[model samples]
Target: MLTPLQKTTIRATVPALQAHGDTITRTFYARLFAAHPELLNVFNPANQQTGQQARSLAASVLAYAEHIDRPGLLAPMVQRIAHKHVSLDVQPQQYRVVGQHLLDAIAEVLGEAATPDILSAWAAAYDELAALMIDTERDLYHTGTEQPGGWSGFTPLRVTRLTPESSVITSLTLERPGGEALPPYQAGQYVSVKVKVPGDDHWHIRQYSLSAAPNGQQYRIAVKREDGGVVSTHLHDRVREGDDLLVHVPAGDFTLRAGTRPLVLLSGGVGVTPLLAMLHAALTDTPQRPVTFIHAAHNRAAHAFGPEVRALAAQHPQLRTLVFYTDVQDTDQLGLPSHQAGFITAATLKPALPLDADYYFCGPTGFMATVEGILDELGVPVTRRFTETFGPSQQFILPAAALAAPI
Candidate 1:
């Protein structure tokens, strides 16, 4: 709990946080890594190198400060972050290390402006937030461990099979060494895969969405070969059948909701992994539920699971799928015969969209932004819009007027 004075002080610091949050977060990460180099094994090197992590932290801090008194507004953000933390097996002690470096960076950056009163208030605020996160993550950890066939921390699983899904995407099927049953997970959840490249000294961990509906026998994750991604490249080029990999329990908050309302699923590039799982689960669990699955890819070569989805649609009368090939070749048949040859637009989507449906989408930033804008223009209720981003969480910005108006 924060005193009224602390809340006021936090509110007063929002402007400064907005102005220098990025620099503060960058400095915090530098100091944190310098003091605790081992943390590098836990964090994404690419996100750090690109400063995406820093920017994300900065935005989160600013939002926290701005809404210090109204924590309810940040529930969704907190839930998302807590799930990510649990996926990484983040411990409570890490909060202390992060908070220390964060405050030090703030003091270093603000200098004269970071007075005793301001620093004190900020420290309390950080403590409150940290406690909340710790509690939330504790619950998540407990829930995961309580599930049947569940275990804490990372477990070694053997890669039983591998199939190339597309030019860049390959799906690996993993099972326990002794063929023990695996824990079930909600569709759209992801597991963290930890690997050490043959010559690398430190382990690298990356989260990949489970591409298949949960079965007690095995878990499947689709890896997209990234240009210079350490873990991804290793998974693509070095990992093979009979190899063992450390995998964490599945964790994510992007699962399908419990409702009979029409469900809309949209994806782009490799973002289709989780949604594909959702599609399978929805069809299996509720065959009568109407589902619209929309996906976009550069071309057929880049598209994954097209045949599988098409086959499923053929079998299920309630399932509708739309594919968009942005760079269609002359050889590219529209549609698989039904596919459109351009991007997803309002005009293209209006016919298939259900105005009263629940919308869930995952994709590249630009594609998601376009979809969000279209959904907003179509008068989709904000409560019905759910999205998942691949890397560091991103907040979609709406027009000023939209922000001011009630949903």
Candidate 2:
């Protein structure tokens, strides 16, 4: 709880904070690393250099200040960050260092404008926010203890299979060392895979969503070889069965919200990975729930899980599947061709999709942006639309109040 004066000061300072957030966060990270270089082991250098981590931190801080009077509003965002922190192994004492650096950065950036009242308010706010995160992370850490087959950080697992699905996509089967039980994960959650590439001093971490419901014996993840991308190229060419790998426990907030509402699942390119898991869950767990699963691929050579999807749709009476090809011949004669030859837009969505159904989407930024706009135009409630973006996220423009920054 904040006093009225404190809240006022914090609110008054938000414009400056938002516009200069990246600047402040960068300064804080520099100072922290200069003082405690060991912290580098916990942060992804690529993410830091790309400005993703700092921007995410800035958004979280600004959101917390906005919702100070109603802390519950921050729950979803906090939980997501908690999972990231756990994967990164952020310790309790690190929060204090972070807070100090944050305050110092603010003072340095604001100079004379940062009066006593404003500084005090921000200091209190940072402490409260940091405490909230530490407590939430601790609770999650404890929860993992009581949960069956749970582990704190990434554990060394061995790859059992690297079955190819297409030219670019392959299915990976991983099992715990010594055949220990694996933790169950929700359909759309993703796990981080850490690997060290040649000539790299640090490890690379990337997230891949599960491609199937828990199969009891092995966990399945689908990877799309990114040709020139570091982790993807290694996984495609060098990684193989019997290779030891490190994988963090599954974590994400994009899982299906339990409901009886008619459901529509959409994906493009490799985005189909998570939705495939959801579709499998729907078949086994909620067979009667109305579902329209849509997938888009660049061409036949790029399509993944085509045979499996066809089989699932054939077996389940309630499930409807559609594929759109951006570069397939109009008269092409594939035996199991249920595909269209265009993009998925509002007009295309209307015919096959129920008007009042829950929508879930995952894909490249362009695909999601187009789909979200179509859904909004169709008047779908924000709550009914669930989406996730993999890899680096899209940038967010600072709010209008952020005009105070000269740059």
Candidate 3:
């Protein structure tokens, strides 16, 4: 617990953090990585390069200072990041290292503005926050280890098969090295896949959503080849069947919620990966469950899992599939899967989907915004709409109480 004076002092610095959040986070990461290069193994350099990681951290720091007195208000966001840290096997000691770098960064960035009293208050605040995170992560690690077929840290997995799903996306089936059963993950979870990119001495990690229904024998993930993406390029072009990869335990909170209403799965681009798993889980367990899969891609060349999902819909009477192509090609034709050309709008979807349905959506931020904008206009209850972003876990359309900022 923070003293009243300490809390007030910390609150006073919120404006500075919000104003220079990016600079502080940028300096923090630079210094932290310089001091401990080994942490590069756990962080994605691409996110750093694009400044997404820094911005995410900045948001969290600002949010923390904003809610220093009401720590419970940050529980949902804390839980989300805690799950992520546990997946990467983040230890308590690492918090100390991060704190040192963060404090130094603040001092460097703020200079004279960081008075001794303010620094002390921030130190106390950081310690308070870090203790909560470390304890929460400790509990998460315990839960993961206690689960059946679960193991701590990274598991050595062998690529059993690799199939090109589309021009850009490739599917990889990974199983335990000794052909042991892997733990069954929730439909919408993701696993961190670590590999050494060519010419990089340090290991790089990237999380790919489990793209298939868990069979217990193996886990499947799809990698979309990002141009110049260190990990994606390595996985897509360099990695092959029979190769070994280090995989973390599946961890994510963006999952299918318990509901009996019409289930709608909306995805854009490769964001369809996790939603596919959710779709499979529902259809496999309850064929009569009314579900809709509305996906949009650039063209037929970029569209993935069309045949497989169409076949599933064919087998299940209650399953509905809708696809849209932004830049339709000659190969793209009007069909059950490809419904129209252009983006998903309320006009197109409102008539096709049930307003009472539970909506699960993921995609590029713009696409998600479009979907959510429509859902909001339709007055979908916050409880009924679930979303999972494929990139960093940042913004979410959860209830007001579930989050404030740093969502």
Candidate with more favorable, higher lDDT: 2 or 3:
3
Candidate 1 residue lDDT tens string, 1-407: 89999999999999898889889999999999899887886888888998888988887888788778767667777888899999899999999999999999999999999999999999999999999999999999998898888889889999999999988999999999998889999999999998888888887789999989888989999999998888888999899999999999899988988788999999999999999999999999988789999999998888999889999999998999899999988777773556888999999999988759989899777888899899988998777888887888655222244345553
lDDT of predicted model 2: 0.79
The models' CA-based lDDT, in order, is: 0.89, 0.79, 0.86
Q: What is the TM-score ranking, best to worst?
A: 1, 3, 2
Q: Which residue pairs collide in model 3, if any?
A: 394-407
TM-score of 2: 0.88
- Identify the leading candidate in terms of lDDT: 1
C-alpha TM-scores of all predictions: 0.95, 0.88, 0.94
Model 3 Cα shift for residue 81 (angstroms):
0.7
RMSD of candidate 2 to true structure, Å: 5.0
Model 3, range 176-281, lDDT digits (tens) per residue?
8887778889899999887877787887778899999998898999999997788888898888899999998899888887667899999998999999999999
Model 2 lDDT, residue 224, Cα? 88
lDDT, candidate 3, equals 0.86
RMSD (Cα, Å) for all candidates, in order, is: 2.7, 5.0, 2.5
